[model samples]
Target: MLAKRALSIAGGLAVLGWPFAVWLALTYPELHILLPILALCFVLRLCALRGKTGALSRAFKGLALAGAVLCIASIWMREAQLLLWYPVVVNAVMLTLFGSSLFSRMTIVERLARWREGELPPEGVRYTRKVTQIWCFFFLFNGSVSLFTCLAGNIHWWTLWNGMVSYLLMGLLFACEWLVRQRVRRRYE
Candidate 1:
């Protein structure tokens, strides 16, 4: 489980650093040649998942397989615009996950908070629900901007927003939420 989590963290960082990877690939032809190796890594990770049963798990495995295929295909084709599409797709997937959870028994944020706090008070539960809603909106807006930048065909602008600006905004949101949660817990708990 630790190895799986580490791999997940590395994969997320790779996605976040994709623009830099592209720069390196362009600067050194040998780096571009590593695409197949990356694809193999994806395939290996997928194979390691053998027998996971949840819908979310299956969906993620499918996405990983598709990513592997895309990596291999991109090597033979000239679909450079995919670099722009990646962030948009990733944000959309995340948005779907968060948005769908809002209609379930508990929002994703609530579920996470409960994992830490065990049973939350009614107020805490309500607050987590609101936070999850805010996250859904954030993902929607972020994905929209990513799609707009992709269509605009400016790699620099896409990289600027997706790589740096989007992450900063997310970090700001996370920090603000943490601060607010602390204050709320002190007052009501």
Candidate 2:
């Protein structure tokens, strides 16, 4: 159990630190050295998901597989440029996960809210759906920008946008959503 938890934490950290990892791999031009480590991280993450069951779990597993594949491809092709696409792929996977949930009985945000609040009133349900839509929009926009960074062929620019700016934007969005959610909750109360 402890080993499983450690693998999960390592995998999560790998995913979160991907941008910096890519930046290091690219700046040093030693992709062969780093790609295998990344692939291993993804594999560890995949292994950690072994007993989980759910669409979300499957989606995350798929993401880990994709990341591993990309790393392997970068290594095979001896191309550091391929590593830049990892962020774009991350955004695309996120968009798919969040966007697909919109058509389900409950949006992803709604499920998370329900989990926390025990059950949502009608107004809360509506708010959660809207929040989910906002997240879909964010993923789409962020993915596009990530793709642009890959195409721009500027390592510093890519690192700046994917590594730093995108995170800041995500945090800002989360902060704004929390503030709005508090107001909505008060209004409904």
Candidate 3:
């Protein structure tokens, strides 16, 4: 279990810091070979979830396949830049997960809250749904920015946003949400 959690965190960081990894790989051409292997692993792991329910899981499976295809193409073309698609695909999957949860019986935020707080009040459910919706929009916007950076033909900007700015923005949003949640909880109390 601990290994799983550690791997999960490492995988997430890898995705988030992909642009930097690409930069390093570009500098050392020999590292290019590893990109497709990592992507293939992700594709297999996602494929393993074929039997999982939920639109989000299905979307991930499809996205992972797309990523794997791109990875293979990059390998064939000897284009390390193609690795930029990793974050774009990941953001889209996240967008789908958060967006789909808005219409589900329980939004993602609500599920996390429930795991920690058990039963929640009606207001909490509404709040969680709103938060989930907000995250959906964030992912959509962030994904667009990521795609734009990838296509803009500038590695510096892409690395800056994907490796640093994006995470800082997400952290700010998370911190702001927590502050608002605390105030709202106090008001309800």
Candidate 4:
């Protein structure tokens, strides 16, 4: 498990590097293939880390594939400076908001899932719920503001669009999970 998690982290770092690599090699047209290939590796590694066996993973299969495609397709639209700054800004914001949570190993929502699955004892549930609320508010507030500012466009319109997509993606996944949980709860109740 530790090895799997470590590799996932390593793969994620490499994936994160793709944008910069794209930007750096922009003057060298032959290297255009690198970004998409890196994205493919990330998607593959993420799939491997997921074990390709869970129902949720299967349900999100299309989305995962689409994200990979989008990453590659989006790169085709980006040039040097903008491409490099894209993930740098987004991830920096995410990291600033969730640094402590990252330090704790699992994200707040991850722990919440553990509790929901009965993997966590009752004592941890309260903290998990509180942390989840904090993180969600951060996502909603800072994220929405970022999206709006992007729309106002002192920056590239693409960044704004990217922020909107991020918001939509998270919202879609949350809604899907909530719907599924609601159905399961109704069945049990």
RMSD of each: 2.9, 1.4, 3.1, 11.9
Candidate 2 wrongly placed segments (more than 4 Å): none
The CA lDDT of each predicted structure is 0.74, 0.87, 0.78, 0.53
Please give, for residues 1-189, the per-residue lDDT of candidate 2 as tens digits: 999999899889878888888889988875458788988999999999998987678888988998898889888888767878888887888888889998899988888887788988999889988998899999999999989888889988898998899999999999999999899889989
Clashes of 2: 0
How would you encode candidate 4's per-residue C-alpha lDDT over 76-122 as one tens digit per residue? 67643334344334434454445545456665555547856756544
The CA lDDT at 160 in model 2 is 91
lDDT of 1 at 104: 90
Off by over 4 Å in 1: 1-10, 26-31, 44-63
Q: What is the number of residue pairs that collide in model 1? A: 0
Give candidate 4's error at residue 29 in angstroms: 6.5
lDDT of 3 by residue, 60-90 (tens): 6676676667667777888878888777887
Better of 1 and 4 by lDDT: 1
Best of the candidates, TM-score: 2
Report, for all candidates in order, the number of backbone clashes. Answer: 0, 0, 0, 0
Residue 146, candidate 3: alpha-carbon lDDT: 93
* Native-structure RMSD, model 3: 3.1
Kindly report which residue stretches of model 4 are placed more than 4 angstroms away from their true locations once superposed.
1-10, 22-31, 50-64, 75-123, 145-189
Estimate the lDDT of model 2.
Answer: 0.87
Q: lDDT by residue for model 1 over 58-170, one digit each (tens)?
A: 65676567657767677878554454566676677778877888899988788789879899999998999999889989989999998998898776787788878999999
| Model with the higher TM-score, candidate 1 or 4 | 1
For model 1, the local distance difference test gives 0.74
In model 3, which runs have C-alpha deviations exceeding 4 angstroms? 1-6, 27-30, 33-37, 40-70
